[model samples]
Target: MFLTHGMNESGELVSVADVKSGHTNLHCPFCSEKLIARKGAIKEHHFAHAGETCMESKSTIQQTGLPFYDIATGIGKSDIKLLDKFQRYDNVWLSQKQAETAMYLTQGGLLEPSPNKPEKYQLTRLGRDLVKHHDSLLQKKIILPEATLQEQLFPARLAMLQYHDEMNGTQAARFYQLRLQALLNQHLYVLKIHLQQGSTCFPLIKVGITSRSELALRISEIKRDLQQHGEVLSIEIAGLYRHFGSLERLIHKRFRASQFVIGSHTEYFHAIETAHDLSLLNLEALGKRTVEGAYCRTTYREHAHKVRVGQRKAKLLNNTHLGRPAKNAENLLTDHPDIVEAFHASLSLRKANTKTGKAINTVRKVYAALKESGNT
Candidate 1:
């Protein structure tokens, strides 16, 4: 098989697109042998060993030292789905049909039998790494479309947007484009938290965003908070994301009907009742334009509605003829209440544009008005 990814001198995965067709310095990731880039128009670009093909590259069973690439390279879609389930939930009991896939993951060292329940399986360190590094691994694929790679990287791109007191038209356009990309790339997760209220004990799932680094700290905080009600029986990370605050708000809205409030916390929902809707939890499906898109679309509609309201407010303020016509800069500030609120909250004009869906010109005008008024 042709290698889709090669390792650079720095030991980072390099796709065929990252290099030109020639005797390059890239090495086969599995065998560490020098590789030749083949970017001919006749076939898909990939890496071929300059010398004889190593046994490791020829066989799927051979160790590559990169467990994620080694395990992911051979797995089918169903197998990947099974792995996702393990990553998202704790103590996953496999069906007879799923058992075959589970066995493959277990043999690949991605999963292990649950200590408490042998029938159940849990993600091993390797398995967790596979899911965590999924985006990077997907980018290394020569077969996957560039659009797909961009979609997967949408969150990172959005998170990198720089916030300034004022932004130009181009910056505003880039911000809006990234926000739209974020809507399309929403990745939802179910976090199962075991809670005890009075004499009854049950599991409550919270749909939200959290990174791997913060997950342990979050669980610890939850455990500390529930000390009065009852000890947290268990907590499991069903999924994770980086800087997905917008996605979290959308999820809260989607699952609002199923929300259950415990004391001051309203984020929890009954796990048993929410299980029926869990079929929508497929990571691959969520990343595509599916049910997740519907949720994001609803959010976009809300934003659009707010924008229309702002425009109407601007029109009304302009035509009010209160004593004298309001200054254009002051009118913009009055029109976009969200921008005013953002300013009151000490947010920069660039951030206000992002938060309020206001145009860069509007944000700039409002910001100037605020500056003149000594309110900034």
Candidate 2:
């Protein structure tokens, strides 16, 4: 239904939505509607069904582990054993879904807690596929957590000292916080947020880690810094590294899969959004959608990962009047001896229609340029 965003006492922005990191079944937050219709009359959102409940208000978010829930739903294809990666996020977690969603978001945005529930947390799903793939595919690709880094970060005091010696207190804190990321990338536990509130007034941030020793030392530092300066409110270490990546895959694949979940939840969650934007639900409009992705040259520089060779890529190729010439045109032509002949042949076949002709001509010119440059 509606999207909700607000600032906490700490001034950090918080957003609430049906599709938020902690939510399942992308409903209209306000009305609990499965669909939303933005009211042009006012900025606020409403349900597609006028009489239904609207989105959840700022204070209404239930404390249940929801991200974990979403992950479980999407995990239809992954292994069941993979659920262990999420245990670190919530010691009391009892469901498969919460852990899965939590794992997904931890990689996308930094996970944080509801001030109301300091022990619980939510984050962006950076690498979210371990739970979404079919068992065969999931089982074939997975990795386990690294124990060494976990040990290194285990000693809070030591890490604190290294952090201090390696960087200033501020920088040390930052580095210590980031230490969990290494484990996370490897599909180990992720850092959980420990929510603590203070009354002082210094710029501060919350950090999370896996080890108690490390957490203890880091918390002590924050407390000490605030007490000494008498200028900052107490900062919190709300969470620590729970398990990372898809555990089911790791167990099945024996940690041999790729390091990312581009096709996992991260991919699909994004796909749900992007598919709608790129898709033409109307069968009649399929060509339009295809054309949009393809010939929509407006964004020639889409992210390397985002732009796969889809019909859109082909459409773009079809619409192009100019080929993207090779950097070393001469060398390309020389290296590929058939380039000149192909270009000439292609050029001769060009029709007069702008759309198809443009593409053919583009190929012709690009190769021609290369041939001429190569001879130079």
How close is every model to the real structure, measured as TM-score? 0.29, 0.19
Please give, for residues 211-255, the per-residue lDDT of candidate 1 as tens digits.
233567666766786776786888898766433333444345446
Model 2 scores a TM of: 0.19
Candidate 2 lDDT over 180-291, as tens digits, reads 2222332112212222235522222222222232456545644553344343333443223333221222222221222212211111112222222222211111111111
Local lDDT at 18 for model 2: 15
**Residue 257 lDDT in candidate 1:** 76
**Candidate 2 segments exceeding 4 Å error:** 1-63, 69-137, 140-302, 305-323, 327-376
- On TM-score, the candidate that comes out on top is 1
- Scanning candidate 1 in windows of ten residues, the lowest lDDT window is 61-70
Measured on C-alpha atoms, candidate 1 has an lDDT of 0.57
Task: Quote the positional error of residue 359 for candidate 2 in Å.
Answer: 27
